[model samples]
Target: MVAENSTPHLHSAVEPRQTFRRALDMAARAAMPSLFVMFCAILLSAPFGIPGQAQLQFGIAMCTVWFWAYSRPRSMPALAVFLCGLVVEIFSFGPPGTVLLSLLVIYGVAHHWRYGLSRLGFIAGWLIFSIFAVLASFFQWALVCLHAVALLSPAPGLFQAALTIGIYPSLTALFVWGRRTFANPDQA
Candidate 1:
């Protein structure tokens, strides 16, 4: 009788620990993408002294957002995306709402087409991302112009779009590795 009573108490104790562990795991999994993107934003925003550093930073950040939003929308909800964009905007020191609006647009579009993009080949996905990059660049350019109340050259935006499209493959590979290594296999 004592053994049976102790067994129930032991089981109950272990059960709560397991439940707590699972909850912690789930929360970590959910926050990983947002944390990863924010880290990238901070790292990329560093003063590299490169000729087109801002554009390069923006390109990589956009790619990071696109990969997470397209591949695992649940991991990167809209609010998380907004926060990431805000971080990028603050770090990049661009006009307020430029990067934020562009990233939100990318997230919304990628989330909308995620199922189809998942079904397609990597090349097809790249092609679609190219379109998104250009569109986002244009959108950002328009926003900046509106903010300035004067027309601005489109060259920077175009170059940023090209850089973003060019860098997609490398960033996507890193993201895939991260997802495979850290994310739950069932979720992947």
Candidate 2:
């Protein structure tokens, strides 16, 4: 009877090892594909003109990253997303908080919907992102109106806001598809 009880303990000990081994295997399977996707993101983002289209470019990156966040919330850590946004902001011409705030807001929205990522998940995400972008643009325009930077009309900013909304859903779909098909078999 003591040996039978001890056998159960031994089995429990062995079970965790099996679970750990499976997790390691899954992680190893995921690694190469994740690296490839990261490479593609950097490669595509690197050559784009910065200042002239910085806002639009940032929007595109935000959409892309948000899509990825939905796809693999566990894999793409928040700090990495923030750092990516930081790099884009520094290289592009923008006020420091612009990308950071936008990315942070998008991250929050995406994480909130982490469990429901689907074929139309990109569309849903874009709607949430559009709301944040509108608010951010409005605040920035208000600052400009108040001469926080320079007095400016809100019209052009509104136009850009509309454009961001228009483009985000499709761009998100593209990025989401790229992540799904290439990121890993399980994720796919």
Candidate 3:
């Protein structure tokens, strides 16, 4: 538990500059994991002569969003998610606003249900993520259909959702390690 005595500096109005600096430091520390995931999405989405490379990157992006939101809501703030979504959209070459909207929806749902899922095991988390995957895919498919001015087939989205679900367990374990490694000392 955090000691009350350790936070006295935050209450002192006389040291406003120092308080701001400390707060900035705290924000940077909190953002590291999410930022790393964003960087990975950008790097992995590039053409690397591998089949299904985009699909892999897409799975990673989705899994990262879900894992961070479910495990560390405070660190995975809405602003970060929004910005990451923008970068992801550019990298994935998706319809404008689609990625941002999807990320926001997933983050919102996970943040709201954090407490409810806190006591559940890995299977429950996986199930929740599966549901979000389907919804997010549908949202993207609808966006694509509207953008193309035609009713598009849902096969691509369905394939992506399946791929995401298939890779989630590995990604979750990796993020769990990342959280432990990069987490604040107190949290660790």
Give lDDT: candidate 1, residue 188.
23
Considering lDDT, which of the candidate structures 1 and 2 is the better prediction for this target?
1
Q: Write the per-residue lDDT of candidate 3 for residues 1-188, one digit (tens) a residue.
A: 47866677654765444466677666676887677667877887877887666666567777887888878877788888888877777887767777678778888888888888777899988998999888888888998898899999999899888998999998888778867765542232
Backbone clash pairs for candidate 2 read none
Order of candidates by lDDT, top first?
Answer: 1, 3, 2
- What tens digits encode model 2's per-residue C-alpha lDDT throughout 128-153? 67887787678657755665656777
Q: Rank the candidates by TM-score, best first.
A: 1, 3, 2
TM-score of each candidate structure, all chains considered together: 0.79, 0.63, 0.79
Candidate 3 colliding pairs: none
Tell me the deviation in Å of residue 45 in model 3.
Answer: 3.1
Residue 174 displacement in candidate 3 (angstroms): 1.1
Candidate maximizing lDDT: 1
C-alpha-based local distance difference test score of model 2: 0.62
Candidate 3: residue 49 lDDT (0-100): 81
lDDT of 1: 0.81
How good is model 2 by TM-score?
A: 0.63
